[model samples]
Target: MTQTVTTSAVRARASSPALSGPGLFTVLLAAALPLVDFFIVNVALPTIGADLAAGEAVLELVVAAYGVAYAVLLVLGGRLGDLFGRRRLFLAGMAAFGLTSLACGLAPGAWWLVGARAAQGASAAAMLPQVLATIQAATSGGRRARAMSLYGATAGLSMVAGQILGGVLVAADLAGSGWRAIFLVNVPVVLLGLVLAVRYVPETRSPRPEPVDGPGTVLLAVSLLTLLAPLTEGRAAGWPLWTWLSLAAFPLAAAAFYAVERRADRQGRTPLVPPSLFALASLRRGLMLILPFSVGFSGFMFVIALALQRGAGLGPVPAGLALAPMAVAFLFVSLSGPRLIARYGTRVLTAGAVVQGAGVLLIVLAAWRDWPHLGFGSLLPGVTVAGAGQALQLPNLMRIVMSEVPPARAGVGSGVMVTTQQSALALGVATLGTLFLALVPHHGMRDALVVTLLVQLAGVVLTGLLSLRLPRTVG
Candidate 1:
């Protein structure tokens, strides 16, 4: 069955270019929006809270609501694209995302903003998987590798750039909207993306269409909500009894989701996530490694932003500017990732992890030495080094994970990979950020941040170890 699917997908790819050069750019432009939105709002949260009269706990909810919903429904969104068409879903999602961004910008209350954010996340889930799927279905060989690399670069850069752009927008407070400008900014971008998508983005879908796995879909959603909801929201909500109970149920729900998916696959039905996809060792292990890398990366970003602004008394623009060195280093190094991956194979990832770990250690040491006087200059060495290290790891990991995924299962493959990444990112913030906050009340903020950076350093080491299990080289 897997061979047949691969053969069919290869044949489809042989027929035509799914997108021209200009069209590919349009797809990538659309792809960057969700990732940008994810990180952009982090810097704006405090401003949003002050303006909306929201407390810290509610502010956490505002972020988690989008992430959790986005993670939970991703597989379903991917499957829908497979069932219908990639271009169609892409356009629909883009339109909805634009409307939701508008809703978020105009929201008068915290709860209303939170709801709009969730809607935006859902639309993002619908939109993003198609980017990977279309690339997969449309291209192969060097074309495919180049496209994936561009996607990886876009994904990594958007994360860092989002915060920087958000700070500028909020600080500028265009038309007195203040924090709302972070979201409202998406409206114009989305509109431009819509225009380009309609003109250039080509429609693609699985050549061998399979029925949607209704039971698998429901089980997966339940499993994700069960796992992610409590973890993300629990820390902010004071870790009530229900949160603990929810955490306990996660493993069981996950087991059930797998069981249902496996049964569907054996019965020759299209499972929400095909069991066969896991047979690709590169894809499987690359995904496993993505968990720790994504989690630690996100945790570090969230905590460091808070530490710079709240702990060190930097304003939003300065806080955002402080990360500019990291972003610049990330982009510069990331462009060379494909060449490095070709030469050094997965060793590049290991090298990146080692560098990143060292960078984290540097940050800890800097915090210890500088204490209350920490500034961007003091933080520069560690952030630049760490950004270079991350630039090496993230894009390479993305290429490795998707390397063996046949075009026919592109939607499922991309969905599974992204869901793991998104979930881990949320978990990192919940666990590490929570630990920092918990320790801050007891220890000084400087000490707490140092300890948290050390914890992230450990995660980087684990990722380095996991990279050893990957294939020697990526496609």
Candidate 2:
């Protein structure tokens, strides 16, 4: 009877109260961890390769494994949160994340670390969507908007900070851990997050949660793997025959996944990805902007890290510190984002793109002229301006995404949005990073870096044009 009563009470806790300040902080912290890990390894990769005796192909696997796993499992993780309870899932995922981080840090070999990183990503898939879903369900009106804005700020900041922090950690070599310090650092933070979550986070779930869509799940996984797997690994693997075969299968798999989900929606079943969800113009258009935005952001981070260290002959610390101006600029502009949105609305995005383009051009000029001499001083102006422009775009863009998503389907909405963002980040690394590396062998690093930045500038232009279609006023 006591056990039965406890079960009932657990279920009774589903209707969460408004998210408190501490609760919001807790979720936002959790949110930053995954994204931080995504880019953290950039500065640490060289040390990791040398220490583990791993080659380029295996090193690429270490990054791609995490990204693909994170992207593939995200929606399912969100759905599970809805059915079981979000707070419950958050705790479980956080625990798993801490354990996997420890595993990555302690691994005896490169393959072991790669496996652990994949697990780390899978755990992130379970944890991250809950951050947005919790905000969507537990807050509303202006509070909802504010919470979303904060989440976005945290996300954009984390991506930049990750590499910075990784450089610090790797250089510090605390207790002689070297590159292992990056993964080990997550363990302590995760433990703190777990404790705070239990105390401050509230239980929430769909009032009418649906069962998992198994077929849709499988097809979605296949679709992402078919495209991302080959691309991320192809260049490293020397474009193997299997990579070509996988790339060829991507379209067919995507088509089948869409048809399956559309059919499920038509049948009145809750598909993993509801086609009806895209009917929300805000979500749809916001996602369209996110794809290019994330692609450039991630690609630039990866390529710049490589170019600075390998081409400019900088160490990890110097390479990461060169972007300090960008991080500082991003923070300042991001804080003012809500005010700007209220005043100028979507025009801010266009203005941001233009400013960001100018920043990119400045960086190209710096790279072309400075070449091996390019250091923090030479790169400062361009990176600072670019960061500010990105600040205007990323956080506000995120607010526009969930602006119109209904509260009940918040889990699914957050899942879909994040999946798109994560997949794009992976592709950015795959495509832009590929382009830069491919150019380096024939063109040398300076020309390759300049060309890559030029390509990214083109993407910034595309993002600005897409922003024009965004609703003038996001709710």
C-alpha RMSD of candidate 2: 3.6
Q: Tens digit of lDDT per residue, candidate 1, span 389-446? A: 9999998888888998987788888899889988898889888988999899899899
Worst 10 residues of 1 by lDDT: 11-20
Name model 1 segments beyond 4 Å from true.
Answer: 1-16
Best of the candidates, lDDT: 2
Candidate 1, pairs of clashing residues:
none
RMSD in angstroms, all models? 3.3, 3.6
Q: Which lDDT value does model 2 have at 168?
A: 91
Looking at candidate 2, what is the lDDT of residue 233? Answer: 98
C-alpha lDDT (0 to 100) for residue 400 of candidate 1? 88
lDDT of each: 0.87, 0.93
lDDT of 1 at 186: 88
